[model samples]
Target: MTTTREAPEPVTDVELVVLLDEGGSPIGTAPKADVHTDATPFHLAFSCHLLDDEGRMLVTRRALGKRAWPGVWTNACCGHPAPGEHMETAVQRRVRQELGVDITALELALPDFEYRAVDASGIVEHERCPVYIARVDGELRPDPDETVEWQWVEPERLLAGVRATPWAFSPWLVLQAEQLPLLAGAA
Candidate 1:
């Protein structure tokens, strides 16, 4: 009588805390030895909600060419810090990378606030986002690669746009709107 061999266990990269990249399959698991190796987690991120002196939020529409949530509307600026990079540096880098502008001053509102995306949108920002209201004092040039369009829209109109067209925003964006004082003040 012939017997079939048992399958071996899967493997995962301790550094990434994720399954090993096996071309395109998600069949890897953490090895028993490395499972408790205690690598630093990989969910931390940062974002800046820049505001002008007029109180208008600096909003931008994601480039249509994006793979996830393309053409969606979002806050002033958002990005993830590179490994070993500081929060301030990362925020500044992202602003330039996405909006082609620089932020002189930043205000940190929530340093430990985190919200997870509800889909496979390639976006998983577990951020300590430093929400800032920086006055605009420069040019505007939306990077075609990161942003398709950008403008300082009134908070009232922005919420109206969201209500009228909920499909134009990511789930997290909508959730953040709940905390905006624009709605109550406008009403």
Candidate 2:
């Protein structure tokens, strides 16, 4: 007698973000797409600053189609950690997705980097974003949906530019530079 076997159904993955309370405690999870709006709630996210062997930082311009901070230059990558996802894992995943490159020497630079900003279009971004620094390990191939343009520049020069014209870059980048020792000033 011959028996017929059925194939297992494919599982669908819905991207979810961890929502945080005022005290930075994980409260619950929400769909990533629904979390960002005029009243974006506090969510767990991360920002990564990529550097080459010579210490030049990689910066990218946010795509014009982004809902928040479109067309503005910012750090190498930023992303929200999925529900139950590790912060380091999320950073690695996002850098690969956005810049098409892998990174090493990942270090948590700002563990309590939280910010809330309102874009000109009234879109709000409220995140408990931890900042990271990593060294690039592969060739860059930025995704058009995430990055329109990219360049590597000295961290000090980048800091000077952001300081001189804060309006030209992402609010988070400006805020991070102010707190990060590596970009604070020439040592």
Candidate 3:
């Protein structure tokens, strides 16, 4: 088994959010001067669409102990952009943070986009996100702090799971899945 380094401390300033083009590659990083104290401006994140040999996507039931969407079912891996970090760097970092595993390979996802939402429970500043797809064959160990449980299921099964447990995932995940074609396969 390969061990990963600890993720660096996050840079909360909006300016610290690294910049990426629609393809989730580094176009440039935000300048510190452009950073805002109110909310993370670039709030860059990476999430992978993991498909195993059987075409089943590995989904995780975020530990009910997560700060954002606890017990929510999300794509294989996800996490935020750290200061002075690039998209690729964040991708590896997050995979290790959420699930005790490092990605073997990652491919960019389609229709890269951003959105905003607020609930009484908490406010998210994920103005922009860069999605990815990683193929792996390793044991997954959910960090008690980040995720509670995880599983591998077919895409249709995941959709049903979401419907049965709406609050179990971030709203954006559901919307993103809808935008994707059912047959869409990722690298």
Candidate 4:
């Protein structure tokens, strides 16, 4: 972990992300900005699906200011953990940061989900984003800088909407939907 001024510095895309080899072992690190070039390199990332007690899953729209896939509806949250950071710890922190909610348990639905996508602006996203399902039965106060809109919908309805308007959602979310069965046993 990098430190500065007697305290842990803030984690931002301006910092670095952990890279992985074909075997999923940490190989090295690269500045977040440099990792998403035209030829994006594979990096470690995560996606979280927040479900309410009523079986409604939360979905959020990426802030318009986002450099990639802005205004697109996606899973509850997505973020990258720094090198040596545990995935669960990262997800917990991200949920609190992005959704203003706290969670204690996480069920990893897709441990090997990976994808490479290039947005219209040409920025690329090549990541090994493991998907996790978490239950949150409370209001969502999303960070305006990270998410523009948020809502809860039944899993089946969300899947149907995404299929009916596939272009309205993120590519990874579409892929993640196909693997929803992995979350069948989740609460």
Strongest candidate by lDDT: 2
Rank list by lDDT? 2, 4, 3, 1
Q: Residue pairs in steric clash, candidate 1?
A: none
Q: What is the lDDT of residue 142 in candidate 4?
A: 85
Residue range with the least summed lDDT across 10 consecutive positions in model 1: 16-25
Residue-level lDDT tens digits of model 2 in 76-185: 99999987889999999999999999999999999999999999998889999999999999899999999999999998899889989999999999899899878986
> Could you give me the TM-score of model 4 versus the true structure?
0.87
lDDT, model 3: 0.64
What's the C-alpha lDDT at position 150 in model 2? 97
Model 4 ranges off by over 4 Å: 1-14, 182-187
Which residue ranges in model 2 land beyond 4 Å of their true spot? 1-10
Supply candidate 4's per-residue lDDT for 185.
30
lDDT score of residue 43 within candidate 1: 46
Candidate No. with top TM-score: 2
The TM-scores of all predictions, comma-separated, are 0.65, 0.93, 0.69, 0.87
Candidate achieving higher lDDT, 2 or 3: 2
